[model samples]
Target chain A: MAADWIVFWVCAPISIGSAIAMLLQRNAVHAALFLIVNLFTVAVLYLVLGAPFLFAVQIIVYAGAIMVLFLFVIMLLGVDREERLVERLRGQRTAAILLGLGVVGEVVFAIRAGVGFSTRAPAGFGAANGGGNPQALGRLLFRAYFLPFEVTSILLMVAAVAAMVLARRRERPVASAERRAQEPIEPSEPSEPSEPREEEPVG
Target chain B: MLGQFLSHPPVELGPIGPELVLAGAGVLVLLGGALVRRRQPRALLLASLAGLTGAAVVSVSLWRWRGHATVLGGMVQADRFAVVARLILLGVAALALVLGHHYFERLGEERPEFYPLVLFTTLGMTLITAAADLILVFLALEILSLSLYVLTALSRRLAAVEGSMKYFLLGAFSSAFFLYGVAMAYGATGSTHLSTIARSLAGQTGNQALALAAVALLVIGFGFKVAAVPFHMWTPDVYQGAPTAVTAYMSAATKVAAFAAFLRVLMTSFQPLTWDWTPIVWGLAVATMIVGSVLAIAQTDIKRMLAYSSIAHAGFVLVGVSAATQEGIQSALFYLLAYAATILGAFGVVMLASGRGEEHTSLGSYAGLCRRSPLLAGLMSLFLLSMAGIPPTAGFIAKVNVFRAAVDAGHWGVALVGVLASVVAAFFYIRVMVLMYMQEPLEDVEPDPSIVPRLAVAVPALLTLLFGVFPGLVLGLLERASVLRW
Candidate 1:
């Protein structure tokens, strides 16, 4: 129990502090690194709560894979370019701060009142057993949650298709013509082909 | 070990046969788009229509074979309500695809992928109506919404991209709220299945705060989807920015699907908390109707006007839902069917009236459309009249049924508000009509010469009139259909 208290006291602050830092950081890369720290600390906190499977998933899926993806995006998009930070709406920041504070207050009150802190597990909760999280989860998922599982797979496929469709660049002869017109006068060099080659032949 | 688990219970696929067929069709269209050397847009369109028809057939068969049954371990319910909703979605999808085929071909954008996306979206909508569990609802909602976001931007115009981005961000935020609500509800009831939650929440007054919070969160989430007041900032912009066919589909099919799920969740799982949530929904209904009608009167763009009009229709539907009675559900279902047909027809005419580059959507562009093409102008007038809830039109019957249900359920104030709002909404619809028939042609633009879009407009117009004259046909069908049996 003392060790658990120690872990909570140490990891909770780290997680909360890193989350704030992540939000405050101006540099995208620095923000991403802070997010990784926050995720790692949350994983430790999950471990302290005896959710070993969730802890592992938090570290592996979020801290490892997702953070890497975020860093890659930041680098690919050029991390040094500062965002404009335009305030499109009047009093937006004030309203955001007020809402954020309200949320924090509600959360704090809930925690203090132990609204969701129950020692007893509800009936039919499959995750009550220690060290059997993954196996029990698999059993419940495949047995009772099979339909949602399959639907989730379809959702992922739809996401992939949507990304592909949105990211695809249209082959425009007009664009090529404009590019050719903008090119410097090079009489000695043969004018580039009228139509750009179909890069990947959109299927 | 696997065999032991498999022996738990045999999974049944009959309940979800429509979803399966639609998903399979979507996959086939996608693969054909990827593999075929010469992209045949016409063939793809035909295949998508056939798939939707097949799915409709399956849905009808399911409704006949087993009118109501919880299947796939209670993840979904194959009931009369879901089957009917699926049929409506399929019909809307087919019409929208037909409209899209001509719209894209006219614009010279050969996007074969459009058909597959439509199929996928229809699949999502079908699953949403059938979903009996909260998890399934969220998954299905994401599938439908993500495809719609992409479809909104599919035209590749700057406005299209901007609208889609705003839609995607706001939609994602709402989805997170919905998921959080699901978690809270699960925490409260220890189950995500609507039947189980209803059972657990029945007559239990202790610890009601969490449950009330869950209800509010869920309502907020669905309000965004249905474009209710305060959560409806995205509707007009997205509708105006998206392509006409897509806007039509989004306006019709999304409402049908979202309202189906919304009514299911509220009527089934949250039924016991009616006293708590009814007043809130009553306020929303009033606001949505008034805002949608009044603001629409100020819009010059035909699509933007239609967007606001759709918002008002959503309010009328919410009036029925807030009543929370059997008659209310039946009337809401009938209203959805009526609105879907009428809106699709209205937008189809709008698509046809536009020039080759889709530049003639403004109200000014519609001036003297009667002189341009009498058939197009006549069809537009029929649809607009239907929207305005004129006598002998489907919209009038729908509004009357819903308001009657509200009044019967003792929501006389809400019913009154709905009637007054409809009166206000009629003004804008009439304004469009006056523009078409009374004014001079604005630039002598020719109507689109596509027979397909004309057929699309004609079918819905005929159906709207048929339903208007014979509301009893749909009302009787709804009478026989069992809803929320779980």
Candidate 2:
């Protein structure tokens, strides 16, 4: 348990530091890297929390995929501006410090109050099914939350169409009134003599 | 085999027939929309309109049916409470469709997805109001929230995009807090089912600190949804920026659904912890009422003012929830119905007057409306009066019911605070009325002869009077609705 605490203490600074760096870093690519580090640390934390599935998901989806997308977007945009450290005014700096302190205080209070961990037995205890493992989640998805899951898919489809519609600029169709009036005198070869096309001239 | 399987729980399928019908209609409309590409949305519109009417019929059919029962193995509930609440919700959905049809037509932004989403969200809201389990409640909240997020951004304007983003971000964050609270409460107790929690917590002593913290987190989460003070920073911006029709639907249906869920959770599950939460709720209720009313008077924009008015109404509903009495629940239900009609009508008129681009968000734009369109002006006045809790308006009866319930619950101080808030709120409502009727025309405004918006406004405006004068009608329906078991 003491070893676990030492491990947590060591990882905690790197995790929190990377998170703050990710938010404050002006260079988008560096921010993405920092975020990946933060997410990897989170996965480590999840492992400590005995949530192996969540740890895997955190590493695979968030650190791997989402950060890659972030990097890709940053590279595609080609914005390599150097980090500009923001000069905080005295009042604003004080306000920021106060807000940060308040948040820290709240966290301390919550910890002191012992409000985070469960007193009762954790979910999936002595049960065949567990808390949202891949298989159990799949079964729950298909059986209980099937309708909502289907609806989410529909929402995704709508979102795809909406993105396409919003991004694409299609031209409006015009009747070309003058072309219709001036170029319409010609007729295809007739089998028989046809009456001349009548025109009513405007006054 | 399916029948035999479902019969074990003895499902109350009859009560949920309306929701099922709406759900089916939503899918049908979506399919019909895809099939009829050239004349897209016409068929969808017809189907959704038919669906809304069908839902109303189903609501009426269940009106005579009473008592509490579970449906779909406790995933959904249908009782006297949900029946009346759903009827109100469906009615608002129908009006919203009418207003949306006209608004979209004028703006040339008609799409088939809008109506179906609205109906589905309404169905979700009905389920939310009757949810017995915490998981079902969360799912229902998501269903309602996601649809509204899309609806808020449907206009695709700059303000709409920004407002929807803010609303979505804040809403998701609040939901996280709520989910965490649910997790903690479930940890503290042994179940996610509300009744089980209630039963488990009954006779359990000590741990007041944890219990208070749980309820506080829960309140913070629900406070955002209901737009209570301190968590209401998003309400005005979202309301002012969203399409007026969507705002109308949200202000009415969303509030009713959230309050219903809030009351059920508190009265059923958290009643044992009442002493810990009542004072906090009382403080919140008073603060919300005063701040909502006081701040509303300072707003120049009409939509912003109404947004604040909604916050104040939320306070009133919270008062009832705090009372934790059957009368309190019933009164809140009645108030919800009245407020739904009044706000919908008010927003309907706002939609009519604002034209394609919705430029009439400010209070000054309403000046000389009487000269421009007397019929519209009169309707707007009636809505304002109802909102102000004037006699013979549904708002008045609704407020009285809540006040009576609070008094009966021996919360005279809370009731007094509510009355004070109403008095202050009246000033702004009357201010709008005076602007519409007493002021002279400043600009040359053309009256838009759109029967859809007018009828939409008129029906609810008339209902406000009908129900206000005959409060017994809706109240009787509400009385027949059974509060859910803890």
Candidate 3:
């Protein structure tokens, strides 16, 4: 247990440091690579917490598929022209302070209330929500939470449709003549030839 | 007496037939869509037809099995209340689907995916009203929310993306609160089943603290879904930005599902803790009503105005919920059906009148609509009047029942505030009517003939009048179906 604690203590800082560094990095591609490393470290943290299922999911889902998709979009779009620096305007600092204070107050209140928490090392996940075993999770998911699971699939379908709609260009392009027709007409000034048009002699 | 007969257990499969039909229909639609994707148009048409048929079949089944009963291993127990709510959800989904057929066609987006999504979402709503467990409630909530997020952003337009982003972020955040609350409650009571939890926590230590937190969090989460005060920021943007057809579906269907779930959570799981939670709810109800109606009056954008009106109606429904009685639950169910019909009609009018791409939701665009299209204007006015809770409209009857429930519950302050808010709400509904009838035609005024919006307008308008003239038709059904087990 002491050894485990030592490993956790060592890894935690590295994980958090890498995450912050990844966010602060200027080079877009480098930041993404760092994010991959940071995500893997978080997966390790989940493993330390004895949640192997969550650990695997974290690595495979958050680090692998979702991030890859993110990177693909970012690379495909090419971030150079689109990255705009944001400036904090006046009174924004005050607003942030107030929000921070509210958060602090909430945390303090929770702490003061002494909400007994059970972070005790679990015998297994199954004991959590009436047998948190994966099989139980599956049963609960299919039998009790079946509707939400189905709805999620529909959401995915909608996402697919949105992607298709967003990606697909219109088949018909507007003709130049139509474009010109749609343009508002401006009154023409009587042709003032600045350097009187060079006289073309018929002779 | 009917419940006792059902409880006799020898032969009592009469009730819960609607839920079974919906479940059957959902499976059919999903499988059918998967099998025939290559024949896109036909598949899409078939999927929608299946959804409509399923909804109709389920609604009819519910009508036949009006007496209350539980089934399917106690996962779903339906009385008149659940039946009526499910029926409303089905009806709304049907109208929304009709509008969707035209909407997608006009937009040249004939994805069969829309019908399956709508079918599954409606199925989720039905399950929500029938949910007998805490886990089931949360699951149903997510099911509805997930579908709506997609539906809210269905348009693939910039506004849709923006609106959906706001909705998703806020919605996901609220869901976390709900989950946390559930976790707390589970920890406190060692059960996720509402009835079991109630029994376990009846005299348990720290039960008040845990139950209060759970109820509060659930309220906040459900409030976001229903467009109640403070959590209503997403309503206008999402409603205005989503495809009008999708918006109509969401407005009617989402509200019904959320209230059903909310009422279930409050009345079932927290019944013992009501005295601890009722005052807070009383405050939220009054504030939601006053804020929703009053703010609506100041909006110039038609979509935004309707969004505010939806919030106001949510408040009215909350009054019924806060009553914490069998009558209150029944009234809430009836009110949801009434509000769904009226709001669907209003959006149907907007969708019908809207140009292709739906860039004309501004109030000014509706000026002199009566002169251009008398039938459309007259229908729109009927919807608007109903929304304002005017007589001979379903909305009025819904509000009266809710108000009676509140008065019965001895929340006279809330009732008075509701009445005042109704008066304030009338101004905006009337303003829309005035714009349609009295104002001169704007320079760019033109009718875009689309079959989708027209049908959308027709069904809800006809139902509004039908339900309005015969209030007992739905209310009586509600009374017969209402189950009062807590």
Best by lDDT: 1
Query: If both were scored by lDDT, which would come out higher, candidate 2 or candidate 3?
Result: 2
Clashing pairs in 3: A126-A131, A126-A132, A126-A133, B79-B481, B80-B481, B80-B482
Badly placed stretches (over 4 Å) of model 1 are: A1-52, A55-60, A78-127, A173-203, B65-68
Worst 10 residues of 2 chain B by lDDT: B3-12
| I-RMSD for candidate 2 | 4.8
Selected candidate, larger DockQ, 1 vs 2: 1
Q: After superposition, how far is residue B37 of candidate 2 from its true place, in Å?
A: 2.0
Ranking by TM-score: 1, 2, 3
Who wins the DockQ comparison? 1
lDDT of 3 by residue, A16-43 (tens): 8888898788778778888888888888
Write model 3 residue lDDT over B1-486, tens digit each, in one string.
555323423323444455456555556665665575343655565566665666666556655554544444355566556766777788788778887877777666545557767876787787788777766677767767776777776666888889888888999998898888888788777777677667766766446677778778878888888888878889989988888888888988899988888887777777788887788778788888999988888888898899889998998988988888878887888888888888888887787776666878889999999887788899889989888889898888888998999899998988899899999999999988988888997847566675556766877788788878898776776776655575
Instruction: Give the range of the ten consecutive residues with the poorest summed lDDT in model 3 chain A.
Output: A169-178
Give the Cα-based TM-score of candidate 3 against the true structure.
0.76
Looking at model 3, residue B447 earns an lDDT score of: 66
Alpha-carbon runs more than 4 Å astray in model 2: A1-203, B1-17, B58-68, B71-73, B205-208
Query: Per-residue lDDT of B381-463 in model 1, one digit per residue for the tens?
Result: 88888888897889989899899989999999999999999999999999988998999987778888878789888988998
Error of 3 at B136 (Å): 3.1
Q: Lowest summed lDDT over 10 consecutive residues: which window, candidate 3 chain B?
A: B4-13
**DockQ comparison, 1 vs 3, better candidate:** 1
